[model samples]
Each structure stands twice: as C-alpha cells, then as structure tokens.
Target: MACAQAYAADTFVIKDIRVDGLQRTEPGTVFTYLPFRVGDQYTPELGAAAIRALFATGLFKNVSIRTTGNVITVVIEERPVIANVDFVGTKEFSKKDLVTSLKQVGLGDAQPYNQALIERAEQELKQQYLAKGYYAAQVTTTVTPLERNRVDVTFNVQEGGIAKIRALRIVGNHAFSESTLLDQFSLSTPGWLTWYTKADQYSRAKLNADLESLRSYYQDRGYLDFRIDSTQVALSPDKSSISITINVHEGAKYVVSGYELEGNYLGLDNEFRALVKLKPGDTYSAKALNDSVKAMVEKFGVYGYAFARVQPAPQIDRKTHEVSFSIQADPGRRIYVRHIDIGGNTRTSDKVIRREFRQFEDAWYDADRIKLSRDRVDRLGFFQNVQMGTQEVPGTSDEVDLDMQVKEKPTGLLGLGVGFSSANSVSFNASVSQDNIFGSGNNVSLSLDTSHYYRTIALSSTNPYFTQDGISRTLNVYYRTIRPYTSQGNNYKIVTPGVNVQFGVPFTEIDRVFFGAGFEEYSLNLAPGAPASYISYVNEFGETAHGFPLSVGWQRDSRNSALVPTDGRYQRANMDYSPFGSLRYVRATYQYQQFFPLSRFTDVAFNGEVGWAHGLNGRPLPVFKYLYAGGIGTVRGFQQSSLGPHDAQGNALGGAKMLVGDFEYQFPFPGTGVDKSIRMSTFLDSGYVWGENEPLHLADMRAAVGIGVAWISPIGPLKFSIAHPIRTRPGDQTQTFQFTVGTAF
Candidate 1:
C-alpha cells in the first residue's frame, strides 16, 4: 500500500468514506480518528492528520490515507494484543512484583503491544535492581507473535553482585570530630553489623537520611549556620565497591542573647513565656527553640485554638556571634470540635478507643485532652501507631473535626518455649493471651509452666473499663506447686490453689488505687528429706491451712514509655491482710523506681523496695507468703531466693522482712546506635531478707556489683546479669551469672 503522502496535493469533498485493513478495530473507531467526515472538504493536511492521529493512538503499526475520485480511503494495520507476560532469571524481586511494576507503566497482557513500552519496561526493571545494589544487573525484552493477532512478551534479567561501600570520608568538619559526626549516620562502610543493618549498601534514600541527621546534629549544638555543601558517590570499575564523600560547612557557634514573645497570648502571656527553655548566654539550640514553639502552640490549643500557629524568627549577629529568637503566635478563630472521627481500627471496637478519649464530641477543642487521649490509647498496647489529625469541617470556619487514626497490631500472643536459667536449670512454658479480646478492650490470659522446682497453671481476665468512671475489674484463679531445695534432697512440695478479684479505681490521670480479696488453700506434702521449717509449720498450723486475704494498693506512674522508660518515676504501695484465715497476718510493701536521662543515649535508673510482714492473733504468717530476694530481680550475686535465713537442713527459709535497692547506668549496645530496645548496664545492688521475729539491721544487708544486658527480642524480653558479691556472709550462697527469658525485669 502506498503512503498517505502520495496524494498530499489533492483536495476533494467526500460523499462517502471507507476504512480498509481493519482486523479488530471498528469502522466507527477509524472514522473517529479522521479529521473530515463525509460531505466535508478533505485536503492534504487533513488526510495526513488522519493518518498521524491513528498512529499516535499506539493501536496501529501502519496507516495510509488515499483518495479514490470523490471518496476518501483510510487503511491501517492494527497492533497485536499482548497474550502473556513472563520473566526469567529474576531473583532480586518476585515475578508477581515485576509484573505489577510493568502493569503500572502501561505494559501488560491484553493491552496493545508497543515496542517502545517494552523497552521502557526493561529499563525500569534494571533501575529497580540498581536501587538494591545490583549494579551489574541486565534486563532484555523479547516479543514473539502468537495466534489470534496476539503476542507474548518476556523479560530476561540477570542480577549480579551487590555493591558494598568500601570507604566513607567526610570533609570540612571542624566544630566536631569526623568520627563523632560519622557516628550519627546510619550508613557506613563494611563492619561487623553491616550484614544485619545493611549499612554497607549504598542507597540514595539512606544517604539523604544520613545527611539530614548530620544537619540536625550540628543545628542542635549551636551551629545554626551549618550546611551540607555537596555529596559525591562513586562506584568502582567492577561495580562492586562504592565510596562516599560528604562535604559540609560548620559555621561559627552562636550563643543565645535573649528571646521575645510577640503577638497576643489570650491573656496568658506569662504562662506562654514560661514555656521557653532557652536562656540568655546559653548555647543556641534548634531543639530548644522548636520545643518552645510547640509548647506555646499546645497551650493555645488548650483553649480551643486548634488552628493556632507559633513560629520562631531568629535574628543573627555575626559580629558578636550571638542569636536572638522572636517567637510569633497567631491564634485563629476559636474552634469547636464538630465531630470525633475514628478510623484505621480494623480489629478493635470503636468503644474500646472512644472510652479512652477524654475529649467528647460537640465540645470545645482542648489540645491537652486530645493529647492525653492519645497517650491513654497508646498505653493500652493495642496498636502499633496512634495518630491524631485535624480537618476543617466543610463550610464551617470555626468548626473542625478530630480524626484519631490508629493502626492496630497483633494483640493475641501464643508462646511455647523452653529456656534455661541458673535458678531453673531448664523449664518449659506455654501461654496464650489476648490483650484486646474480641476487640472489647478486655484482657484474658492462660499460662502454664513446668519447671524442675515449680509448676503452675493460671487463668486471668481484666476489664479495663468496668464502669464509666474508668474503674477496672480483674479476676484471677491459679494453682501452684513449689518444691524447695529439691537438689539438696529436700523433696517437700507446697500446693496452693487460689482465686482473687480486684478493682482498680483511677484517682488521677497517672494514679490508681486497687482493692482486692482472695481465698487461698495451702497443703504441704512432706517427703522423707523435708526441710525443718516445713515440718515445724505443719506441727503448729496443721498440714493444711486456709485463708481469706484482702489487699489494698496504690500506684503512680509517669514514664514516657512503658517498654523502655528513660525518664519518669514509678511508685507502688500495697498492703495485704489475712484477718479471716487460720493464718492471721499482715504484709506491706513499698517500691519506688526513677529514671534520669543523662544524654540522648544514656540514662541512670534507681529502684528501691521494702517489705514487712507480721503474725497477728497469735497465729504465724503462712510460710508460702514469705518474702525472698535474690537472683535476677533483686541482688544478682546470690542464688535464687537464697539471700535469707536457712532451715536446719540448710534449705532456703524465706523471711518476713525484705529490703532491696538497685542503681544502674544504662547505655545503648555497642554498634547498635540509637536503638534503645537493646541496652547494657552497670549496676550496684543491695538487698537482704530477715527471718520471722528477726530485727531489721543494716549490718545484715548484702551488696553486689554487676553488669547486665536487656534485649527486647522477637520471642520476648530477655535479661542477663553477671555479678560478684562485695559483701557476703559465711552461709550466703552466691551465683555469679543469672538470666531470664520470656519475661520482663
């Protein structure tokens, strides 16, 4: 067929139109591409345009337009459809992912196959491999004609070796050492942890993030004018090695001259001014400045100024190298919450989250209440992320909507494992728990443990909001058997079965009071080599004893994070009274924990606990309820529960009074920068237990120094300690190393 240019000079008025060489395309479709209809004057330009438009649709491989007297003729050869798409020799990415990538770029089965699209897809595939460090990757596309005017497209890929970083150099750094600045980066040259962290792989995204970190590091240290000039990344000839060079400029350090608050503060100027953390003559810190702005804005939000804006304008003086900050505030129209929208909670019930919110619908917007609600929801441990966003209500200037977006996480835990510790040489444990059972905001757990010296089965349930006032109810039933000093031929076992109910009443945002009652039955099984204390207890109180125990407790926690607390205080005071039991006694305990962050990567923690128990109504306290302190949870330089008085057979005889104190300095694990989940600590622990009727004295206290590690692992939290006794008695039992798994310390 001749091309459309053969009749470029001809012009005519078409009385009829005809389309030829149409296999799957309709005549109407071809007519739609023509610039002239029947009875319309058709010229050389219109005929050429008709051909070009049909070809531009990518549906035709060849197009021709000609004139037959007064009738215009159009002919086109349609492109073949893609019958199938396939990939070969792809390992870096899955076949499904590759196909999806191709589809996203208009190259897939059943679509009109074009050679240009095939080439573009191949290039894109190669780029994806390059991003993953496969610098030598190769991609090629092949098209094969199939039946029914269709074709098959195949992508062949060869993924080669990964490019590793060989050297990293930072230039023009003076305010801080090169090593110090490099340590702040997440990317690095080959190292021991490179395999896990993938820090040795050169990534554009990682480099960008590292550069931002470097900028923040300088800005936070008074280098307000610091800048990253340029970054150069070079790959080796073999495409297997990479070298990075970062150029930076560290301007002169500046000190804060002063700060001024600008704009109306709604009659709370003094309150807002007090939120500023920066002071005159102090090193200018970007973090402090930003925090001040955030504080002021949040204060405005407390008064329903949801759209308030607080910005810091810095005035720099190069002569004196001093900077002053002027904070500007703009509180827009007061906002009232029109609606409280909840979203992204696929598994959790709305009630579970709504009850946690202190802010109510149709109320004035309060930033403090919304923040507290977010925190409370986070503390529930039911979601991976909780975010709050404000959206303007349509057609309303002073009304806004609060959207609480939550990403739910797995709340059900099934644990089955075997572990070894110095105390319980080997133990097998299994547990099933659901923190948000059925999305009803209730907790249920069943646990069973089988150890060499102890066996237990427990079932518990807790309703966090049993009442509208935020009162929690908990019920527990448990059975435990404990064998004391079984390795030393003391085969005595105490079996206890008990049930308890408790209620937690919220007194303040961070304080709660708990009251509970329990019924317990204890039976002693005396073997041939039972301890003397067990025999004496049986002789005095009989083989079996029952008790009705009542408990009252108070707790206050203000930690920033429940999992890894770096700042705040935790305190607890509890009392237990067995006034209606054969064993009449009273026990009281007080505990205090405080954490102080020394720097971004280090913290100091202190813990202190004291307990005392006394017999009443001429009946001795139950031996099973005695206080024992040692091992992983207390003074680590001693055997498990062995820091107290002993029976005639040298078995551990737990005491009625106990005291423990621990001081620790925790730092991040080496090579795992900024990861708080894994930490190392050097600690000093002192504790002791006194027998019944024994007077408490400081001389009897034991002390130890140790090093420990805490890691939050996939299975659970793990803690290990190695210590040496600094003060010991002749009869004291010492354990140099102890560890516990599947539990928190």
Candidate 2:
C-alpha cells in the first residue's frame, strides 16, 4: 500500500534528502538511484523518474516521494528474499534435481520471492511429472514469511497413478496389416511384462518416434509417395488412460528405370556411377537412393574435397509407376589441414592419443585417415564418445582445421562373484582392473578366486606405449591350485606357479602379432581318495615338473565396438610350445567370430573355436595344459570342463583336443527403444572335448540351445543364460542356468 500522504504535485530537492521505511536497504542506496540530488532543483518530472528508477531495481515493492518545505522524503518497502525452497510429496524426481532445475529458472534460494515466478515453477514441476506419464498430478505452492525479511517456499505435489496407453489404432495402411504396423510402434497396450518395461505408458516423444518409424517403413519399401496424414491422441476423463490413432497413406510402389551421372565428377564419372545401388529393374527405394548419395559424397572426401555436395533429381512417370534419377555432384575446393586440436582428455595424456592419429598437420585432408584416427581413439576404451570434424579457416576457402573432441569415461572395472553348491559350500571370486591407469594408458589387473576345491591369484600389467612406437609390453605372474570335487570325495590337488612377459607389434591398422616366453612349475599332491588318472599321472611324471613355454599369436579385429559390437569379424590364432622342458608339448588354438546385421535392431553372430595339442621332443603333453570345454564361455547347459574323459572316480580329465561353436541372434531388449547397452540374445551352442587317442566325430558333439541377456552396467558387463541340453550323452552333467559378471570376448 502507498503512504497515506501522496507525493506533492510540486517537488523540491533544495535542502536535504531523507529515506524512510527501509529494513535491509541503506538510505544512501536509494539516493544513488535518485535522478535529482540535494544541490539540484527538483521538478515533479524528476521526482517521478526517481521513483520509477528505484522500482526497476526490484529492491523495493513500494515507493513514494514527498516534499515538506523544500525537503524531500522517500518511503520504500523491500521485497523479501527467499530463505529456503523445499518440495513435498515428490517421488519421481529427487529434490536435488528439482533444486538444480529451479536455479536455472531464477527461482532459487536467496532470490527475491515473486508470485509470478512461483506460479511458473509450479507449472514446470507439473510438466516434469506429465512427461513421465503422470497426467493426474497436482502441484500447489506456499510461501511463508520469516524473520529478517525472508520467506520459505514449499511445493506440495500429489503425483497420481501414471497414465497408460489403452488403445492404439492404425487406419489406411493397405500394404501392411494393422498388426504389422503396430509392431513398429514403441507404445502398446498393457501386457504381462509392462510392470518392468513400462511400454504401456504414453510418452509424447515415443509417439513421435513411432510416427517416424511408420513413415520409414513404407518409404524404404518403394512406396515413394507414402505419407502420414495426421495423428490424434485422446485422454480419458479420469486422466488415467490414453488412446492414440495414426492415419497414413501408402502410395503406389514404383520401379527404377535407371540412373545417370549428370554433373562433373572430376572426370571420374564411371567411378561415381558404379557407386549407385539402384538397378534399372529394381524397386525404387529411398534407402538405396540416400545411400548412393552418401557414398558419392564420401568418395569425394577421399580425394581431399571437404565440401563435396551430392544431390539426386528424381523423374517419375505416374502412368507406368516408373522412376529415373540423376545424381549431381560438385567437388568443392581441395582443402589442406592447417592444424589439429585435441580436447576433453583431462584424464588421458595428449601424447597417448596423439600417437594414434595417422593424419598429419599441414597435409591435405584425407577422410579415411581422419576416420581411422577417430576409431583408434575410440578403441582405447577410455572414452564414451569421440567426434572429429573439419572447421574451415576464416578468410581461406582451401584451408581447414581438424577438431577432435572426446568424452572420457571410467576405464576401471570391478568384478565380484558368489556361488553356492548343493553341499552348502560357498565360493567367492573378485578382480580389479584399470585399462588407463593414472592417465598414462597403462593397464593393470589383479584377480583372485577363493573356493574350497579351487583357488588362484593372478597379477598383470601392460604399458601400451612401452617403446614409443605404438608397441605394447606386458608382464604377468600367477599362482593356481585345482582340486576337483566329486561324489566320491577326491582328495587330490595340483598347483602351478608361472610368470611371463609379452610384446605386441602392430602389423596393420586392424592386425597385430604377439610373442611371449614364460616359465611354469607344477606339483601334484595326493591323498588316499585321489582319482586313478591323477595317481597314474603323478607316478609317470614323478609328481613334479617344470616347463619353459614360448608363445606366438596373431589377431585381426574389425569390430565397430569392442564391448558391444553390432557388426564385424574377429580372428585370432595362438600357439604355445615347451620344446626343451620336462613337459615338452605343443598346443595351438584358433577362434573366429563374425557378426551380421539383420536389421536396425537385430544381429546374428557366430563364434567357432578349435584346439589341438601333441607331444614334442619325445614327451607327452602336460596334463595341466590340456584343453577343457563346456560352460558359459564354451557350451552352455553343461557342467564346466565335464565333457571329456573321466577317471575311476568319475572326475573329468581335460582332453587334448577341443572344438566349440556358438550361434547367437542378438536384439534390443523389449521396450528399451534404441539403447544397445542392454540386449537379449538366443543362442545355439555345440562342442565336445576328445581324448588324444579317441576318434573325432561330428555326431559325438554335444549341443544346447538357450536365451541370454547382456547388460553393459555401471559396475561391469553382465550376462545371464538359461539353457537346455539338446544332445546330451548318458553320463553328461547338465547345468541349466549360468551367469557371469565380467567382460566377455
């Protein structure tokens, strides 16, 4: 409210100035904003301007200026500062998150409280809840005055039940059935699994994505004139359910007549024409046309044309439903890289990443080299995102700069496991690893397993840039003991201690060769209930043996991602030989894996492995060096290492020959949308281990079929499978379920 006595029509500032009704603001502060000081004459206009200026500062809610005998008096009231902002009945979003969002809207603690701002905050909070499908939520704000001209703000919310998608209908989709079209949508009616997937909730963003998918489905299948006419969403009166309807037009399909290159392709018209994927008799597909244009542009980039442009002009015949297209390409000026800039590598040294770049500064831009550099950096497994782009230099059309940016992620892994047997015995396992230790691009790991029947500890370290030529050196030391568990209570054990050093040389961008040497000492201990095979081996090998092992290996990997690859091929082969030791033998193993993309969200992967060993220098292969098959990494639905020969006590004796194969179809988990970090796969696995003297037969291989879930979680990678053995032998041991909580290659 204004003062009882208003400002006089005539104003004067001849003698002095006095400010009243100020609780926190000082009198001098008001004078600073006053247009007229005591020494200057004051008119009614100047007095009104001073009041307007003081009000603009937001420091005072009310102000009045009056004059009594050439003296000026200014009365003001200050707005209260918000002392606290609190939320009540908020369960969907954390209070901290709400506070951060409020600060962005200028309505946080210490800010002057305003009714309009409070109203906006209430509406925004309601919007946040609505985005999560909580359409019936309510929000009410209260402001309470406090001491020292402060106030407390509180938002009371009643978040009702989430609105569900009850009905979904598609109209005018002739080429595809309604059910097929609905399958492409992410939203659906409530199902048994909706409690976990939440697919039955109505989200505007998901709805929009479904619309795009519907459009693409037709356009990619030669419906050149396909279009989504309109969409309608309706909510129930109770606001607890939603229904959506989408209307679309599936136009007539068209066939390609032909394609021609009309623009200058740098005198390489034939080369550019070969890149076109649309054949003359094939159906006209938008996907194929877009792919052709993209390929042409990338081809130009390969020749240093950074600003290449490619566009397709389509000519259609409505009468015959035929289309012909002409591709126009303009190879822009050739660009030279003036500089290269690296950013967002706070945890990793610049040298560690710079060494991986094949593109050099002051050279012509090569798209292939730039792409290779980006992939190499991403393959380091230290960053979540890596991006590279060319920024044209100012005042120069032929010069550009390469900007590389990365978003670093945690490169540390912590693994833990716990299991219980039928006899109530518990086993524990753990491992700690860091791939980029201390930001030096070094790797170190320690692993331990504590089980009543088996125990082991291993430590390893690697320096990726040990020689500064992209060569890597690694050292490994380990101790292991194995005591097989059987129904007859086998009381024998084997212990081995070993050390090794290895070095890797890069043969190509995707290939590497590795060599290593190691020394291992083994000892066998027996009790009264030991297995017959173990006792016989102990007698023949004299209970203790030493081996000097040498190893050579080669690998070629072209996977798009190391942790979760959707496509690529990986092949690795390794050989180990102990030529001059008591346990002289040679062992070789080869593995091949390839992934095929079946659709945007589906892939098929096949993995095959084979191993063989034999005596060398007139000595038999070491029993400890024999290969074992079955279990999660080999054949699921079978006991670990239980597919080979057995002793008198029915304990498995690992075989000298092993073969395993796995075929899996991977897809995103239902309701996950496009998130690839979590997915599901169906697998068919078959393998068997054979004794050195036994005949190898394909019919003898054991097989199993199963389903599994793979998750790249915050802690580590996790995999769980439930399988049923389809080709089990009479004495085979089967385990229907298995899970692992670490990375698997």
Q: Measured by TM-score, how close is model 2 to the native structure?
A: 0.90
Predictions in order: lDDT: 0.87, 0.86
lDDT string, candidate 2, 1-745, tens digits: 4333347686454698889889888888888998877788888788778888897786777788878888888988788989999999999899999999888778999887778789889888988899889999999998999999999999999999999999999999888899999998878899987877888898888889989888887877888788889899999999999999988888899999988897779998888888999989998888899999999988888888988989999999988989999988888899889999999999999988899998889888888888999999999999989999889899999999999999988888878775432333356788889999999999999999887666999999999888977788999999999877454544778899999999998989999899999999999888887776667778887899888989999999998888888899999999998886687889999999999999889999999999999978666677778888877689988876778777766777778899999999999987786799999999999999888888888888999999999988766788788888999887777767666686421
Query: How much is 566 displaced in model 1, in angstroms?
Result: 3.4
Candidate 2 clashes: the total is: 0
Query: Per-residue lDDT for 495-605 in model 1, tens only?
Result: 999999999999999999999999999999898768777788898988999889999999999998887889999999999999986867899999999999999999999
Candidate 1, residue 573: Cα displacement in angstroms equals 1.8
- Model 2 off-target regions past 4 Å? 1-6, 11-13, 57-61, 77-89, 95-118, 140-156, 192-199, 203-206, 394-396, 419-426, 437-440, 463-472, 485-490, 617-619, 736-745
Q: lDDT for model 1, please.
A: 0.87
Q: How does residue 254 of candidate 1 score in lDDT?
A: 93
